[model samples]
Target: PEVIYLAGIIDRTPSSIAMRLVNFASVDPFHQNRGIAGLSGGKKQVEPIWKEFIDNKEDLLFESEKILAEKESVSIDKKFAHMLIGIENLVGESKTREVKVRVNQSVFRQIVLANYSSKCAISGIDVPELLVASHIIPWSKNEKERLNPENGICLSSMYDKAFDKGLIGLKLDHSIVISEKLRSNRIKPYYKQFFAPLEKLKIASPQKYLPKPEFLEYHLDVVFMK
Candidate 1:
């Protein structure tokens, strides 16, 4: 990921990156030792990959426990005991790296929901299952912002689709901006009911997450048809 590679550049020379990768790949029991040995770079060349893997591993080990904490998600907390049982399935002989991915996603979702009071940012819909922690900046476009809560906005399923497709955008001041097409559509009333009022509403919980201005600008300029 860009964040991983960037950190490698910041912290280590190219030669160190290479050697570290070989060493990590060799010692990681889950990976084949032969593959590690086949890697033929100095420490600098392998630094990026090594750093990322180590970082992910550390996050998994540390943050996975935090997942059980009630502050993250009330729903998850209510069923925390059951969740622990499911997590146990991934431990020991059944352990898989995918478990970490699941945990990461959970963490992201909790962060988003907590920030929005489990309500959609635009529609104020409070249905937990229907809400999404949609990234303001496309997740694939920015690795550095991948897990940044400020990079996310809580959105309902329908509005999430609209926002993701650029049918709507938010001004830096957090006012809703409807695309001309949407404003002119027959469904304008429906849109107005849920979205138009947002223009006047200050962000409900600015403390939970602040939308990145650059990402908002990207949506306004490129994504919103207007």
Candidate 2:
């Protein structure tokens, strides 16, 4: 349905839209590493756009959303009205900055959700409201990779807070690791039901943009509780 909707807006067939996505997969490092090949002929055509996304994700993603909104005959502000609430009074550069941040954050969440098939990587929770686009590296700590899909993980709200607080972490192999702080509560029912089961368990692999090893290492070194 989404492909058909996008195809109608772009004046392309659904097959073509799907093929374009495949072309994107062709250049994706995750797919390439897994030996999956997309249509080779269109790979070159998508390379430049992919490179641009890698270089300046914030601008590219926001502009892409704006373009989509325009093509659908809607203002970007209207399209994202739900997220723009409470920012109406601000004017000038501050307003622009805040809007961009909110929109980009929305885009990041969408990408992470799509990558994980809209399920939490740890708990497999499929409820959208319960999910979060958890950053492996603290967002404030890494500006360059702030919007990188490889730096994000799909997690339930409980695990997201746990991760953010360094109460849980991921090993390089993608297995969950419980912090000693969390393990200290092993005798508690909540710990028995939640934290204990997750220890050393592998997270579900994303469809694309697997978390980068470097980002995981950074989390382990700086964010993870020893």
Candidate 3:
């Protein structure tokens, strides 16, 4: 998530990312001795395979709990503070800034995936690593929908970025709408090649919480570039 939100790379959920970390730990040479025994079982294996984990359960549990909290979507307050600090050099990042809200990213993802069937609304990319929960209404614009899953859509990274930049948007009928700028030859060839064809393509319909028409309208009128 640090890589995802902060750096905008490696589009994956916390759980999928956690598994990758576990795989890396298995081969990490520095922690070889401390690492759990590999599959094929330890030599002579007198103790149970789960012994190490069982014995350290309390310590591991505590650490896992910390990770879980971190995995949850950041509180809206923390998110705002972080953004403000980056943009305005906010010192101490104001924990008391009345807008202290946290966003549980995992929960948000779950809700978005539930709505969009765990795939990009435009491209239908099923690979979890390439997907993001995009807000139909910009996060800063709608405080109430900051963590509201109904306000989110599962979009691939490219589409997400384009949508955020107002280069593209969803029509009232849920089709993709490419902005006129992207259609200009002045734009890169790839921009026209990639986005031009998406115009009027109906996005995958959400199963449950269809994005509120007002939110879509807000994006179209306020956020989308004409």
Estimate TM-scores for all models: 0.56, 0.89, 0.55
- Candidate 2 lDDT score at position 45: 94
For the record, the alpha-carbon RMSD of candidate 3 to the native fold, in angstroms, is 14.8
- In terms of lDDT, which candidate is stronger, 1 or 2? 2
- Model 2: pairs clashing at backbone N, Cα or C within 3 Å: none
Q: All models: lDDT?
A: 0.66, 0.92, 0.66
- In terms of lDDT, the poorest run of 10 residues in model 3 is 95-104
Q: Candidate 1: lDDT of 123?
A: 66
How close is each model in CA RMSD to the real structure? 13.3, 2.1, 14.8
Please write out the lDDT profile of model 2 over residues 125-212, one tens digit for every residue.
Answer: 9999999999999989998898989999999999999999999999999999998998999999999998888978999999978899
CA deviation > 4 Å runs, candidate 1? 1-98, 186-189, 195-202
Candidate 3 wrong stretches, greater than 4 Å: 1-103, 186-189
Candidate 1 per-residue lDDT, tens place, 3-42, comes to 3554454566666555565566654433553343534444
Q: Judged by lDDT, which candidate is best?
A: 2
Model 3 alpha-carbon miss at residue 150, Å: 2.5
How big is the positional error of residue 61 in model 3, measured in Å on the Cα after superposition?
22
